[model samples]
Target: MQIATLAIIGASPPVRLARMPHIELPRALEDYFAFAETEPTRNGRRFSITLPYMDGERLDRLQWWYHVSPAQEQMYEGTGLVFHRTRAIERFCRHIERWLEITAQRFHGEEPIPRLGQQASSVATPASVELTPVDKVVNA
Candidate 1:
């Protein structure tokens, strides 16, 4: 088994638009990501999600480190998914796909954006389109 973590860093506008007002990046992420709880820290919230193997064994984890200072300030966040089982890599990749989709809808008005670590290349595909391979997504 191999262990690794993949993350994407995204930024949202601080000021509210005429239609969309007060979209707090961290709060929006916590709401859409659907994590159990956030640990209160001096700076912000520490959110985590854990997935175990089918045999009820602890194996992988996805962690998000988010910090928001003041309601109207820009949000800087990192979302990382770590896994130890190479066989279950596809599952983790799908999870990242959904996370990015929801986040883009919430903040970017459903506009398709590029992958986190890549240039201005489009990452969005239609519903009928097949997803990119797990290796590509992980490397992206």
Candidate 2:
């Protein structure tokens, strides 16, 4: 999973580039990442990804922040998985794999539930391979 530059399709002028790999999460996990947010701060960039948020059930999403400092330092402790913060992106990817494993068990081998926070009534259009810097695809 080497980092690569992604072109910002349909982005406004002064286009931005995200220095990350194409995420491999699928289905509901895919939808969850679709709403992922990236905030540019004076220190660096902060990327946020979260658990399934459908039907407006508030379950302390504030704890899911992902921070990347100016020196390329990263710290992220998944709100649902292990609480220990990690600087390695591969560890975070493992966090996602762990979530998928548990979620599959939770669903009893059925398709993972769509993110409840989106209030999506359907599970269509999972993700975007290309997009603008701030683009968010609504599942509903």
Candidate 3:
């Protein structure tokens, strides 16, 4: 059994977009799921869909680190752990699929924009002019 970390974001409850690593799938598995939607994120984007899976736990601690931590550095600061279990890969896939579908439908068109690192150098405008560049000239 392999462990996978799925990220979800949206306004509504219990819906999420999942980002998964590339892997091979059996032909029989393709029919079991459907692509529901896609949404952008701070880094890039995510895709959503529906599939089959069993046993899902909405983790509070994990959610806090993944979703809430980056919002305000002073408030919540910590590293997150991966929650995993030995279950059928199919089941894991399915659970993520359902989450993606729900999250997509809720925040369909709107996606969060990532914050840029820092503000650029302040540009002085005519109204806020301090000193003219001509005044700095030295007589030669």
Candidate 4:
């Protein structure tokens, strides 16, 4: 199945990614967030949630992938599965919903960073990312 990883940029704990396609993301994401070695880009910070395929509950391989950059207001999405399969499409949709739920919880509101006499302007707000087309990513 082709799976897409949701990403959120500019948020605290600046790196987060889904580890598996079948597993749901935890409510408290303290230890679940991940960061891979990627080249620096104009976007503030890139957080990825890559979803690998499951073979009857066992992870087989990565098929589809997604990368969201809130700073750049962009989402890159792609899949590698052949078009002849319908299961891949269904799995991808399920992954997308789960990803959205996790993102909503992680970035619900602007909880200002606590600092004595800090200017409000210095605070950051949630912004939309631009969508970019990409090829599916494989785990290295």
- Alpha-carbon deviation at 85 in model 4, angstroms: 31
lDDT of 3 by residue, 21-114 (tens): 2222322222334443235455432333334322122211101001212233232122111111112223545554455454431111111211
Off by over 4 Å in 1: 1-34, 55-60, 72-140
Q: What RMSD, rounded to one decimal, does every model reach?
A: 19.5, 20.9, 20.4, 25.3
Order the candidates by TM-score, highest first — what do you get?
A: 2, 1, 4, 3
Off by over 4 Å in 4: 1-34, 43-45, 61-140
Question: Which candidate, 2 or 3, would have the higher TM-score against the true structure?
Answer: 2
- In model 1, state the lDDT of residue 41: 57
Say which candidate scores most in lDDT. Answer: 2
- Which pairs clash in model 3? 15-103, 16-103, 52-94
Q: If scored against the real structure, what TM-score would every candidate get?
A: 0.22, 0.31, 0.19, 0.21
| lDDT tens digits by residue: candidate 1, 103-137 | 55223222122113212335676579665756543
Cα lDDT tens digits, model 2, 1-140, are 33333222332222222222222323323233322447688886566555543333443221256655655532232221122222223354456555545444221112243332211234588786885585676787
lDDT of 4 by residue, 1-140 (tens): 43344333333222223344323433322223332424546653333333333333344322333333443234222221111112333455455446545544112211221111211243588798999988997899
User: Distance (Å) between predicted and true CA of 80, model 2?
Assistant: 26
- RMSD from true fold, candidate 1: 19.5
